[model samples]
Target: MAPACEPLPVQLGAPSTADPHARYARLREAGPVHPARLPDGTVCWLVTRYEEARKALAHPCLSTDPAHASPKYEHPPWEHGPPQALLAEAAGRHVLHSDPPAHDRLRNLVNRAFGTPRSAFWRRDVERIVDGALARLAGRDEPELLSGFALPVALAVISEVLGVPHALRARLEESAEALVTVGGRPATPNAARAAAGEVIRLMTGLFREKRAAPADDLLSDLASAADEEGGPLDEGDLIATACLLLFTGYETVAYALCNSVINLLVRPDQLAAARASPALLASAIDELLRFEGPGDSAALRYTTASVRLGDVDIPRGECVLVSIQSANRDRCRFAEPERLDISREPGDHLAFGHGIHHCVGAPLARLEIEVALHRLLTRFPALRLAVDATELEWHHLMPLRSARSLPVRL
Candidate 1:
């Protein structure tokens, strides 16, 4: 059993975009879990330490299905309509949000699409895309990394995998941005709704196309699976799943890659070490994920029964926010938690989450970042930041964290 400590008073309004380590350190020192406020003023139990977070995330009693919890515990940006409803209705039929038997079935169907055969094919494709993107960056003096490279690479890879039409990629990009922005205070319900509608329409059309003439891509695999299981998913489920995959698959990798680059450029020695030895790049990537990962918080999990984490007794239906950023840097799990040590041996990190809900795209994400970084370093040996690191803008809202634009001198 994990050790318990005294519960501390919750910090109400810390800046979401600011470095969270200081605040998380305070919380961890005080206890395994404590109360914290969401962006939209929803109060939740912030689970900080690695062991406690893992337990909570994988706890069968804590439900991922939003329907089991009351409205008061709904995720923030409430005005945009219930996220659970939107996910169930617009994105895919049933996905990470669903519980047990249903979750298993849905996950199995999608898992077939991302099997070893698909990954083997994508690995080569990812290498080619990364090499091309880095080559484009070589000629420029100061390239905006996010815009010029990371975003495009991630978008292209996901688009190719999903078999989305080349002509529709621009609209997909626009919709992804709109969807992410919905998490902020200036919520654009109408625009987000429109984007969701467009995504659904586009994916629905693709599903039909695949049903008529199956291809080797992920969509065809999903269509075929659906047919084998009696029928394809309902239109709403299909759309929701496709949209979720489009945004989730690309956004996480884009931000993570950008963060990794920013970390490497800021720490010259680490960059040198990685450049000098390619094998170390994989461990360096793990450290980067722990040090400044793209996800600030895990997807929301609601309590099914009263439970005590450390000194706090969280009641049934209360929301819990697993601070992935904090857990990755816990002093208990890592020595000198705040420092970036590229060569450290990997143990267990929440970078891809844990238990049954672990990120399904972990393999793809790792391949993209590793290939992208290796190619960039090899191509442009003197790559450096264009401006002072402090001047670069950072994204705050949305569960995903990233730099707005990373300007780099190659």
Candidate 2:
């Protein structure tokens, strides 16, 4: 008979210190699952192991509905308020936070837009976007990688894919930042509300435009999907899905690109290796995802019923936060997990997550990051941080983890 694993000791209500790696490591070593406290003082389970984390994420007992769970678990501040009408109109209609069936339906419709043929078709467009963004950074002694390259590349690709108006792209970017900020750093109540309004307004306009024109973008596909069998998702659902895609597509991939560039620049040998052989670029990107992919914490999953994981018993409606950052670093899963080895193939990292809710835009993200990195490295051989690495600050309290700025000198 197999020995029962001991219950992990968990720290509930831990302070929001800058780095929690020490505490997280302790929890991982003790057991696969443990109890933890959220910023709003709510208690939940934190899953760390590779296997358990995968099971917990795919478990049917876990629900993604914010309403059934604690209000404190809301991502943006507006989620807790009178629910931005546009966002509410779109939430359940999309797959990001929906359960099966509805999730399946919505995902199928959107999947058509991201199919192999469509993705292959977009390769030329993606390259154009990447080249244009990198070109702007060329011949400069110092370039703000985050603002000058990564952000723009990601924003352009996603915006163009969704057929977002070029002029409103900047506004959408601001709203996206504000949306992430509301759930992330501490902000004044008014500031949070204002950011939420901006996101709601931007998405509302895009939804209206898609409805009118029905172009060749993802938004149009979604808008047209409403007539499909299973009853079409309403305006709110459409808006919510679009907003969610924009936020997920832009923020996470942008940060990962910045981190990957920093990683390669710091290790010239790896950069040289990647340059000599382009095949290494994919592996290098995987390493970066394992080392510093965004979403330091996993998406919140609420328990639908009482369930036992290891020695811990999670109650119904209890929030479970999977630490992708921690899981990626689990020693049992990856050898020398702490070290960044560009040549080493990471079997599978949860950076894109696991199960049904895994990132839908991953293929697109991979293509964008790969192209951006290849061009940035090939174009600027002397790329180095313009500012001290330690001086850069990460966006605290945000579910998506990334540096606020990455200043680089070519």
Candidate 3:
């Protein structure tokens, strides 16, 4: 480690706080990995800068499992419950928390169900979902979008994909909001646990229903994701994997929508550029992903051994938070890094991460963003923020960024 700097503290910000893009600019200016501390005072390292970050993300030395994380940190690996485990631990042994052959195993099983969204059937469903939301917004006066539009669209698409029954969706939403939150972190541990538990009960029963009357959908395939001997995954494994897929897409996609739409609204010029060329919407979504992504850091990855990134050597077992927000805005890779250019192709932003841990739902997420934004903008050409940009409340999620609500008047 070069070892000449003030420690960068990552977890101090309010869950609703916004990133000080400048702080990252300085980190990139100096070096990549820096000695840092978690909110719990566990000595760790923070990696910014593009090249070093890409290396760190895909590096063999980094372990995604919380068991491999620095042991000094306070709280149990799954303290905030399974949804949190979905983010941190390889708990229930799902992919986001896994590595290598195990990661490949879990991912392949889930992939059988999450087939291409680009197919005519799925695209029509997505379009219908998006257009319905847009249509509802059209007649309202200064419609509030967080719950009304963004959240529902995200949930509906995933529900359709998951084959969650309509009857359970209300409970699912209540429990889902309890288990995980958008533009924010999950609820308190006890609350999240209860919510997560309810979700488990609901999904487990849903899976059983599917078993008796097998449906041609993702949840059915997952409920039946076989073990080495070809029997269905046990109850706990089934629920964990089931919730993993739903929880993974639920809030992140919604918050991502909030981020991109708010970005366009606040910058009229960029908004105009996007509106002028429908062809550029896809590129704009990529830029939005790079600019204000769903996460600040990739899930905590523990170093397996001392590894040198640039001049800094991250020690064994210390959790390394790879700053995707910082890396995506890196001037070394992105020209005019701070500027929001809808046309610029921000290549391979770590928005969905990289390598073995790349988001399995990347295509679904892109489909959501592209369809939601395109339809929203096209349907309401005069759509603009109803409130001043400064009044917009950001979610206080450290590492994850999103707006609490977006108020717009057509």
If scored against the real structure, what TM-score would every candidate get? 0.90, 0.87, 0.90
Judge candidate 3 at residue 1 and give its lDDT: 43
Q: Could you give the C-alpha RMSD of every candidate to the true structure, in order shown?
A: 3.3, 4.1, 2.8
| 46-145 per-residue lDDT for model 1 (tens digits) | 8989998988889887777777676775443232123334555565545667677767766777777788476788979898888888778767888888
lDDT of each: 0.74, 0.71, 0.75
Off by over 4 Å in 1: 1-17, 74-93, 181-187, 230-235
Compared with the true structure, model 1 gives a TM-score of 0.90
Superposed by TM-score, candidate 1 places the C-alpha of residue 70 at a distance from the truth, in angstroms, of: 1.8
Measured with C-alpha atoms, the lDDT of residue 135 in candidate 2 is: 78
Which is superior by lDDT, 1 or 2? Answer: 1
What is the lDDT, from 0 to 100, of the residue 260 in candidate 1? 96
| Candidate 2 residue runs with Cα over 4 Å from true position | 1-22, 70-94, 182-189
Model 3 stretches astray by more than 4 angstroms: 1-11, 15-19, 73-82, 86-91, 116-120, 182-186, 227-235
